[model samples]
Target chain A: MISFQKFRIYINKCFIALICLFSFVVLLPFLMLIARLVKSGLKYICLDFFTQTSPSPVDAMLANLAGEAIPGGILNGICGSLYMLTIALVLTVPLGILTGIYLYENRGKKFANLIQYLNAVCYGMPSIIIGIVVYVSVVKSFHSYSVLAGGIALSISMLPKIIRTTRETLKLLPAYLKESGLALGGSYTGVILKIIMPAAKGGLLTGILISVSRALGETVPLIVTALGCSMINWNINAPASSMTLLIWDFFNTPNMVSMVWATSAFLFSIIICLNLIAKRIGRQWKFILYHE
Target chain B: MNKNHILELKSVSISYSPGSYALKNISVSIKPNAITSIIGASGSGKSALLRSINRMHELYPNIRMQGEILLGGKNIMEMNPVEVRRRIGLVFQQPNPFPTMNIYQNVLSGYKLNKIYLSKSEKDRIVEECLRNVSLWDEVKNGLNKNPLSLTVGQQQRLCIARTLALQPEFLLMDEPTSTVDMFCTNRIEELIYRLKNNHTILIVTHNLAQASRISDYALYLEKGELIEYDKSNIIFVAPNDKRTEKYITEQVE
Candidate 1:
């Protein structure tokens, strides 16, 4: 008969080896995608890529038929994305943080419980469904696909993320911190704003950054609301373009493959830079608050 | 109610839920300008009794308190809890100086929380006076702007004391303030308590019977949820009173 202990040890080793092999298999395609994008994307990047507006797809098609080069840049998309993302962030951050604070302070209350359940349901809702909802509510009401509608849609998608993260972070704080504040004669609002909020600053900022990043790359909501413009537009009531929209639209065209790759690279860099800045700020705040 | 008593608890009973009591019908009067220590085993309601003085127990949604707690002849139950807490400061068991605040800010936190603005010079004077009262001035004088976490556990506890004192409260409630520190810090804190009794009415809850005898002017012994005995500290420590008190004291020593 086989020894039971020996069989158990062999099974554990086999499981470990299998996990390692699967992890490497998962990592290989991701590394290749990044490498391919960087190699092709580097050559198309130029100062003009960030300085001029994108040409219309019809204009590019006609130029291709006439044996002429398609001429334009992604500046309109970059500008539009930044403007819409800023509006969405402003709309969502304050409301989301306030909701999170209420949930934490009035924990186990009926209204707070209802809100928590609703937030969880909203977080799990698909981005496309949210886009369609915003289309009917804001886009149809305004009688135009506009930047404002797009921003509102993005805000809805990001709100649940910010609220959940803020609540979870605040919940991790020790109970004694609040008690200490009360013992110092602080009112409830005073303790929350001065002590608890400041203590959770790094986590709150991280949540905001994560929400911004997610909103920046979102495509489906902007498609249904903003409807993609080729010209640089400053009016919030007018249709606008974004990097993700540019990539989605241009990739399907026969001659605009290079444009799509370049926009992808630009989008990748923005996300990387944003995350790096967030991590650095978190480290600095932690060092100042705790290590010193 | 005697005018000499700064705090009086009359038939006070606390329960977290129906049909159960954490502190049952406890009554005691604390004299002004004296240190009173409440000594009991764990789960004997020492901390609960102390929290009732500053209305800290009301923070919980399920807690129920009956009867009256009078502060200087005024019923604390009828008073605003924020105002009552301002007049009666508390120090917790663990050293919890606001981790985000510097020493100066931590000391001035009471003023800031109450929205009581002060001139820069006034703030400076208050910080110095409060820190000195806890005997932490010389050690932390050079690093006044440093984070409170940079200090040792002992110093952090002292800083918390200074933070409480900055409110200029009439009574100071300390719940096992030295239980988490070293013996040397314990001795120093005990000495500070002794000195502070000259100006402020102090109520402390401690599990250490020896500590109660060492620093308190009066001693209260609690068993389960009942007040078994209370008298002058020297008499309670030296003379025999209740059999439970004697047994507990001897058991601690042995």
Candidate 2:
């Protein structure tokens, strides 16, 4: 007969094996997706893939017939993405942080709780719905599918997440820090600006980066709002083309299918890099805030 | 009578909710340049009484304070709370030295918070003087640029004390400032508190009865928000006039 200790050890080992198998199953799809993207997309990522504006469908079809590479890059898409992203960030970050601060300071108040509830509802909303709403409001009012409309849609989508992150980060901080600053005869604004904001700087930065990546990944919203320009457009009020929009456009054209994979690969790399940086900042800040 | 007391509370009652009082009609006088310890069981309003002096309770909503607190012959309630807080500094139970700040910056945080700009030389002098007063200057003098969180908790608490002292407040209110530190650190902090008595009036809420007996010139014992006993520490510890105070003192010692 086996002893109880041996039985327990056997059971623990079996449990560990089971957990490892399940975790591997959970990660399999993501690993396969990355592998597929890298395999199909790596060869297309050349210098012109970045420097030149995306080729017209006819140009791409002729290049394929002649056994030549695509003539142009997703330059217009890159420029448009950057332009809309800047506007979205400018609109989202400050407003979200301020709203979060108000919620934190007015904790347990009826009005604050109502706002929190509404923010939760907004956070749970579908991105496509937000895109359509912006189309009806901003796009229709301006009579143009412009970068501004696309930016407004993306900002709306990003706001709730940023506010949640800011409030949660502030909440993780010890209450004593605030009291100590106030005790030093610091006014509320002074303490928040000078003390609390500095301490929470790391978490706040991580929040911004993660939100920017999320905004970058949003495709459906931009399709309905920005309406996809064929050329590089600098005006905020003009039609714009984003990376996701270009990917969508490439997928619809038969000869430009390879361009879709390359764009996906670029977007994936950026998002992954951003998430890794955010994770690093989160860890380093936790160590500094809690550990010696 | 008013001339003898540096700070006076006249029937000051605090209630968290509408009807019930957390601190009930507390009337007491604090002598100048002395260390007074507030002692009681948990939830007996020792903290509420200590916080009332600095108006710290106002930070939370739905808490009401009735009655007046007199500081230097003027009503503190009538003063701007910011001004009142400047005159009365607070130290918390935990040693929080502003995680983002270095030792030098932590010491001068009060000035920075108030936006009171100081020349580099003047700022350096204040940091050195405050650190020296806390007996931490020699140890941390070389690492003034180091983060305060890198120090032991005892050193962090001292840095907090130094930060409060940098403001030169009239009274220092400590809410069990040494509770989180070890015995040796507690002794060091007690000694510092005793030394600080020459410059500022202090009101500390302590769970340690022995610590109160050892350092306090005056002791106030409370039970369920009522001030049960107030006298010289020698009297309160040795020959208390109230049975509850005696019971609390005996119970805590065991």
Candidate 3:
């Protein structure tokens, strides 16, 4: 019996080691990607990279001949990205949260179940397809690529994710908490705003942050809708450029290929920061409720 | 409608689905400023009856409630649900303090929910009085800003009671309030419930027969969703009119 126990322990140790090895293997690619991006991208990420517009192909080739770094930065891309993101977030946040609340409240109903099914389909739908749909609907209708079209497409892509998170977070809370609020003689709106919303804020914040990062990383839809502007464009009706668009532009142009790495690295850093903040908030809020 | 009784249920029947009934024609009159314990085995619909009083039955899907529940002569079935709920408070089996709220906020949650603006002094007075009424003021006086979740289960339960009591409703409905607390906390809560009867009419659903007999002025014994006996606690415990009540009491005593 003692010998059998010893054998079992040995097997358990081996299993744990194998599991750890596999988990590390899963994380290895992410680490390598970051390492490569940092190595190739660091040189061009100077003050000019952030403050100046993208260098023209001729200008970049001239700089290359002189063994100089690219003269212009991705300041246009940064502004355009921020502008479209602001529009997308403003459109998506309230709409997503409200839809999520509706789905949660009416769960098990046929209409809610159907909407949930549609939302899941939308969530898994290819971004390229969404890009095409927005292109035809918004860009084609207006006869011009516009920041508004890009914002609308990003909001569409973000809606399903935000709805799912809001619903799931609300579902995780005990039913009695809402009931307790209602029992206090508060209206449904009052209970939801004061009791349910406050309790779910942390989870909601994490979800919204994740969605924001996901939206920021979006490329295909913005490609079809925004169409990538060369100069800084303030007019909503004019074509705008984002970080992903800049990366795409550089990747296509031979002389500007090196700028792609720097732009990708910048985008990656912002997403990492968002994810870290989400993780911190998620950890803090996870312990506050449902302890019982 | 009895003029003496503060709340009356006339043939109140609650069904979760189309055909089946969770509570069958439960008609009971409750006196003001008294502790009435609804005692029954599991699945006896004690909770359903308690919830129906405050329109909480409407929370469930396909839940149908028949018959009139009269609160102070006004038919609650016809009254606005928010108004009915405000006039009567319901505590659940588990302590459910608003997780994001501090002790002081939890106490004042009812008022906040109702949008009744209270000045700083008024807010302070209400929170202190409610917490003290539940005998939790001394234990948590210094930590009013601390999360209510940080408190022990018993303390959290009291905080929940204080939250409900902030509205100063005429009626309090508690479903297994002490079921999750320790014996010491249970004793404290029982004493508090007994004292609360001086100001508010209280209806409590409990599985503990001993608790029912000890704290209640009037006891209601239910079996299979039917009221088997309803009388003064002494008479019901010592000499129940129904054979089922006696059998249940003897079995529990064993």
Tens digit per residue, CA lDDT, model 3, A1-292: 9999999999999999999999999999999999999999987799989988888999989988898887899999999998998999899999999999999999989999999999999999899999999999999999999999999999999999999999999998778778888999889999999999988999999999999999889999999999998889999999999999999999998778679999999999999999999999998888887543
| Candidate 1, residue B114: lDDT | 94
Candidate 2: regions farther than 4 A off: A1-15, B1-5
The lDDT values for all models are: 0.89, 0.92, 0.91
Best prediction by lDDT: 2
Off by over 4 Å in 1: A1-16, A58-70, A280-292, B1-5
Instruction: Decide which is better by TM-score, 1 or 3.
Output: 3
Q: Which structure among the candidates has the greatest TM-score?
A: 3
User: Stretches of candidate 3 above 4 Å error?
Assistant: A1-21, B1-5
What's the true lDDT of residue B95 in model 3? Answer: 93
Chain B TM, every candidate: 0.97, 0.97, 0.97
For model 1, how does the per-residue alpha-carbon lDDT over A10-35 read when each residue is reduced to its tens digit? Answer: 99999999999999999999888788
Q: Could you give the DockQ of candidate 1?
A: 0.74
What local lDDT does model 2 show for residue A19?
100
| Candidate 1: pairs in clash | none
Q: Give per-residue CA lDDT, model 2, range A1-292, as digits (tens).
A: 5798899999999999999999999999999999999998878999998898989999999999999988899999999999999999999999999999999988889999999999999998999999999999999999999999999999999999999999999998878889999989999999999999988988998999999999999999999999998899999899999999999999999999789999999999999999999999999998878873
Clashing pairs in 3: A52-A73
**Against the true structure, what is each candidate's TM-score?**
0.94, 0.95, 0.96
* Candidate 1 residue-wise lDDT at B87: 92
